[model samples]
Target: MGEAIGILGGGQLGLMLAESLDRLGRDTVIVEPDPDAPCSTRRGNVLAARFDDANALQIFFSRVEVATFDSENLPSMPLAPFAGRLVPSLEVLRVSQDRALEKTFLAKHGFRPVKHAVVPRGADVRAAALAFGLPAIAKSTLGGYDGKGQHRLTTPADVAAMPADAPGGWVLEEVLSLETELSCVVARDGANAFTFPVFENLHQHHILDLTVLPARVDPALQQEARAVALGVARALDVKGLLTVEFFVGTGRDGVRALYVNELAPRVHNSGHVTRQACTVSQFDALARILSGVPLNEPRLHTGGWCMGQLLGDVWLAQGRDGGPLDLSAWRDFPDVVDVYVYGKRHARPNRKMGHFVVRADDATTAAERARAFRARLMGR
Candidate 1:
């Protein structure tokens, strides 16, 4: 048997990661709070222990050669004793766990980012809003993702009434009138790092809807985005998979530039397309890193492919009528559809139940097929 790999979270990402590990002829054990989690169903060696349970986590860590995380919730203090054994170190998670610190780090590195300010309780929220400007975004600096802990600030009154329950305070950022959003997912071991092509992302209500590889953007802007993302990885001394989200803004003069929006210290949702479209999947890099293997650059496989998500809202209604609805018709699109269900017990509004990856002959075909897939699920 090969070295045992330990994963910190038990989400869809963990499920996919374990699958990737199995493909690589490796062994893995997942530690999660939910005993009946989706990931455990996929990988049998799952430990149903909350990650914050230090004693249990320590015991779990002792059995693995190295560890990585599926989400950013895991902190370093608990994983420190296994320093060299952690694929992405504590500093990477520490800087990424808080949005404020992430934005500050980017700005200090000369990367263009939306103007932002931190807003905590008993602080002048209105004054902070004024700095970022109207139509700003107020988000919790920590423990937020997929549009949660995030709100739009359209006016001064909106800022004054900021939610007191926000985590790690809040970060107010000027809303960029962006042309589109793009993301670059890359991987790094201790010494070498590699980047994949930029993927254009479409978000509906702050949740990822579709991702197009080799995003339709100016070549110069794409290069800049790649550079900025790779630079961030280096600065953080990150290992394993890292993803950076950017806003592609079009100036009044019609020129385009990239602005850093956020970072994911682990494999990202945008990178889901990589599984079928890229020369090397992010999970492969992650496996290589933890197994003490050198990292190789991921190449775009024939201009790459596009991946779209089929959100839960498409099949179920809200309130009293909401529950697990059948998706038997989904299997019909085998030609263009690569459906991945999370196996979640309950379906909620806007929750990411699963995603589909469609590889068309070209970007246009890929995008159209993706849209058609979404429409079919919605009975359009």
Candidate 2:
């Protein structure tokens, strides 16, 4: 077994993965640009360097047996030379980095995706708007996340108002008035792969607000989504976790169509619940795959649910200019609520400083308690 693993991105997801690695008796070396990143604060021996630097990554990759990323934005070309195991390989990155390419790839496989056009450099945005109609979205082909680098145009005027830099090498798509946004998280080791239950995602202001367990879709749709996800994993020859986001709604012709919205070539925000809800987690799955181990059949041991992404503005600390935002405040709550605080240096607006998850037997109770706990954690 590989003794050490190197992770490329040091967000809260990486923080949780670090803890999982420690529990598995494995060491983690996180390479991030921020010296005071929260993951580094809790985990020792983190290398504060840019993931895009070739020489730095070569040196960093030399020490570890395997490499994985918390997110997909890392430059895949530079790391292609690294000898260590890299999950969701460069081919995956090639297909996923460009929305236009991913959609074309999906369509080639007879999988339906939203109709989109590549806005390659100074193309008529108005033409795309005319083709796709109003209520379309212009999205950057790369480096976009958490609803960033995206423009929702409701009219021709909105299309005209697009930033000059925005239309360059981006994608324009006809926005579907969808019923809901859902994500399917799956892990593969080339031969054998395992998939988790679908997550019915709720977004508030373009940011994920909550994820409901065992998606509310019918069995047929759920199966379609899973099969599509597995096809994507296998087609890309992914060796680790892959999160595929989909838009679920009926088309103008009155037929149910699942449009793949985006793809994350690593562990995703929506899958954070697997830590407490499933016997094997995305991180653990990745670890086994990178180490040449077989995939484990996922078993949901308990009927548990998790809520995360607690905003920093709402979380406070004691004697640090702000009052106490201690977990001890929720001592009365059930132990099912797992608190994970990223040891970040600062708590700025919209910064994901930490997350707390509470599991329960049923959906209603879990939602109620999670909201209640969020209220208390923020001193609301």
Candidate 3:
């Protein structure tokens, strides 16, 4: 029998990771709160319990040879007992779970991040805002994603509106005039590391809407982004995968440069295009690392590819009246390579329910086709 690997969350990421593990001839046990989570329906070994359930974790740990988490929001202290089995280590989670800690770690390690100040709970928000300057962004120090727990302060009134009761505090950052957003995913196993091609991402309301592979940037800049991502992995002594998101824009002095925006210590949403564009997908790379296999550099196979996220809004718009989505329009687009639905039972606005990929002769064409297909899917 092959080794049994345990996953901490059973969201779409976990579901995809399990698929990769299964392809590699391994067994998987998913620990999730929802009985109908995407992973639950895909795999047989599921521990349907809250992530913090100690007894459940004990049972899960006993059944698997190694474990990793899908989300960074999980408390690191609770996983301390299983530290030996965790790939990236609890310290990574410790630094990543808090925005202040993550930014400080980047600056301490000589990586350029946006200028920011930490505002502790009940602190003088006005003072921090004044220091960071107007038009800054206030983000929760912990548990913020998909544009939640964030406030844009463009004036005095906005600063005053900052909540004083936020338990996790906040990090106020000077907003930059971005030229573009880029991301790179790196896979490492302590001894060696490999990076994927840089991806240019488009966002809607701070949530990723599309990703273009082989980013439409100068080759030199793309190389620099990949180097930055690899540097992050080495600095963190990471195992499995680490994705670094960057803001390519003009700094305060008016010089264009890349600034580290955030880091995801596991497979990232933006890297989904790798499934069709790369020799080894991000999920496969991470699964291989977790299963004690050597890491291999992922090479891009297609000339052009674009990945479009399918949010719950599409489901609500197309199927709110009840019944599965009418996917008949998909037949018209031959360039559309794949459609991945998460099998989520409920469709609320902005929730990620699925994604699709398009491949073409060039990045521009692929991006256009992807957008058109997404519009068709949403009945736009």
Candidate 4:
């Protein structure tokens, strides 16, 4: 076998990344503590150790030629030994890991983000939030995703009701008049770079529910979105994949414009539609990039593609609990091209279990079909 690649986390993203590596005949060793993580089924390939296990990392480093992380939440200090071999570099992880740092970085680079103020831990959350002004949100600076670690303050009372101490401090953002959300996945290998079709994403309760492309926006806005994504990748000088999420809304200036929302310096949930929409999926692109394979720009197929996330709630609704979901219903929707289950050990509300892709003649049709399909899946 050829040299192996190491992954820091073994969740669904890691599983998909491993599958991509497998196609390149590259072995993957993952250091993840969760015995029931999505990649746990890989058995011997998994270290089944904590991220900070120095001894396990020594063993892990010895077996791999290169390393990449699936999640930025992994402690960077533990992986210091393999810093030289870390793909995408550790700086990307550091800057993207904390919301405050990320926002400051963006603003420094002249990218407009929602205006806000940072409230340090142990400080007054309510007073700080009110200072940023009422009708805002306070998000913990670290380890928050899928709508977690967020508190909305629409009134002074709401701000006063906020927790006294935020675990990682907080970034309070003035609420904008939201129009829609969009994302662009940018992949790079040194001098070469590629951008996938800009994806228009729809979130429910702060969790992404569906993503469709080409985004149903003005052609100019789509172009601008892609340009901004590239600019972000260029600014960071990152070597792997970066998915930049954007908000199109009425900004504090009272003009509808695009603002950087957040950054995911790895394969993102929003990019899963690439598996069917483009010649090169996001996972495949990252796999090749990390493996030192040359890349040709991916060509988009002539159709609309929509990826609908299947959260754990769907499992409970189907009466499976933690068991395998009933895929018997898939045969009913021809447009539903693919279904991916993460092989998770349990099912609970809002946890992303898998996603499915639908293809149609246009973006609207594809999104409509995807929503209808999931609705039927939930009903039956």
Candidate 5:
């Protein structure tokens, strides 16, 4: 039998990656605990087991020549036995998984992350945050995303109000005064790297709501963001993809600068619009990399695009339990180019269910139309 690409997590990202691999006539093996994971149920070749299960890893490594991950949160120590076959290496995952380690590496390497202080695990979070000063954001150093494991400390008592337990430690970050959020995704093989266009991100309730391509910032800043993402991929020695989220901020001192917000070691949500907006989609880029296909720089396929997230809330708003959405409203928005609904089993508030992309003459206009499309779908 021929070799296959192994994925460590079977979340939506993994499912999408597997689909892209399939288009290339590549085989994929996924290891995930969820039997109903989108890839597990829909794509097959899944070993329904825990990430660190020794028996699962043994079976998993036997069939695949190389491995990658859908998430950076899994334990790297357990995979040390099979580390030789990992795409980006365990060290990359190790640093990117922990906020403290990620911050330290960036600073030590002369990259500026937002100013922050680390509060060791089991320490008094309130006191540490107080010392850092009020009007801060406290995030656990491990396994946080989409607003999870975050706390806002405004007054002296704000940290104490919720008092989130941080067994994995915490990082208290300085809040920015004002500006936009942006992200860049870099695709790399062993010897070469390339970046997608920088994306302007907007969030609601701390969850990524919309992404605008050809980011609404000075062209120079967009160029800088792309360069930063490629540099970080090189620093990590990435063999797949690395996404760097950024902050174009004016700090309290009233200084405007670009700061590294965080890193994701796989295809990102912001890059979803690339499916229709760029010559090569992020998923296809990674698939080609995994298959050792020669890389070519991707160019704009559309003038501009916007991708809007569809949370489970949209389903609940539609009064459905679990199934395809009522996309009857599509006739109203001609610019809405593509819609994707993941085969997730449950619908709960704030959970990402799927996404849609809109192409327009310009990205800002696409963003506006995407928002309106979602509102219409939600009956508002």
Candidate 6:
């Protein structure tokens, strides 16, 4: 009968958060629409209902002391009734869910973001594309992640092929040549905050492929990135976790610059390595904050580490007739520290199902070993 924490959106992130809460001797209630969501299967107290379901929210809020969401895309208006208990606040979610709003918020707060234009619903995509010029990215203002709801407009033909039923507004951004993509995760309570080390992230087909801890970027850039992340958390008055992803590249002035790419209002995929490499995992940190525990700064525990995502492609390679993955090869690589499978029943391309971490004396070796292990898992 201890404090029970309620989580909106029962995906893998919720599952991981539930695990952290359990270890801290707290109870968890997961509210999710899909019965097969990873958290639904793994947790005991689950409310199988849509996030916006009125009756579900009533029943769920009655059981928990505090509530948080795993994803930012949930309709904020529907959760207004429970505003008193939701951490990070609905205002934060509202801003994070819309690309246009997110960009404007950053710019208004004196943070630099990529130059962009907003194409409101029913607006002319062609006009917006022309204004932004070719080689721009057209992204739906809401409900898209991992490269979904996005298009690369390199030619007039591409713009002409725009989807007529764009569900929401759109943001057209000028494409910038990038040196690297980096992310920093910050956990906060009302009065204090802690930031994880900046991580250099690698993406393949717009999906996260690898994350290197202690990013090999200039030490000065790393410090600045962390500072920016902390500033964002403070500005939002966040009570959970906020992850700021940045693009490190040359600006129009030909000087190296850092621009905020986007913000994730919950534990981020890039912070997965913290579970193995830091004194406190991002999940644990958020769980503690929600449970009324004071925030603690997370310190790197390993020399270097790499987190490799296990996408649905790994399952598809099983050829349907193949059995479970042959994980015996892991025995040969002592540096591969942890393997986590989400227990999802089926896998489709680009869907994240699991992840693994590799530790070594340096970032390069850790990345190489992680990639080699992933290739072996795929039988490549």
lDDT (Cα, 0-100) at 137 in candidate 5:
95
Considering summed lDDT, which 10 consecutive residues are worst modelled in model 3?
319-328
Off by over 4 Å in 1: 42-44, 120-122, 250-256, 317-337
- Each candidate's lDDT (Cα)? 0.78, 0.73, 0.87, 0.88, 0.88, 0.88
Model 6 residue 288 distance off true place after TM-score fit, in angstroms: 0.7
Q: Distance from true position, residue 89, model 5, in Å?
A: 1.3
How do the predictions measure up, each by TM-score?
0.90, 0.90, 0.96, 0.97, 0.97, 0.97
Candidate 3 Cα errors over 4 Å, as ranges: 321-323
Tell me the lDDT of model 6 at 201. Answer: 99
TM for candidate 1 is 0.90
Tens digit per residue, CA lDDT, model 4, 207-265: 99999988999989988998999999999998999999999999666988999999989
Candidate 5: C-alpha lDDT:
0.88
Measured by TM-score, how close is model 6 to the native structure?
A: 0.97
Please provide, for model 5 over 1-380, each residue's C-alpha lDDT reduced to its tens digit, 9 standing for 90 to 100: 23999889888889888889999988999998986567767545898888889998998999898888998989888899988888768888999999999999999888889989988888888888888887999998998988888988888778778565774799999899748999999999877788888889999999999999878899999998888888888877888899999999977667899999999888888888888899888889988998898777777775778999999999999998667899999999999999999878788899888999999999889999999999999999
In angstroms, give how far residue 112 of model 3 lies from its true place: 0.5
lDDT of 3 by residue, 248-335 (tens): 9986668788999999899999989999999999999999999888777899996889999988888887866322566788999999
Decoy 3 TM-score against native: 0.96
| Candidate 1, 1-380: lDDT as tens digits | 12689888888888888888887777888888885467867556788887777887777777787888888867657777676776677777877888888888988988876767877756666676777678888888888988898889897778778675576778987767788999998688768778888999998888999999778778888888888888988888787878999988754345556778888888888888888788788877777777777777888777436788866676563222233545555676664647777877666678677788887677767887788877776767
Output the lDDT of residue 104, model 4: 93
Error of 6 at 10 (Å): 1.3
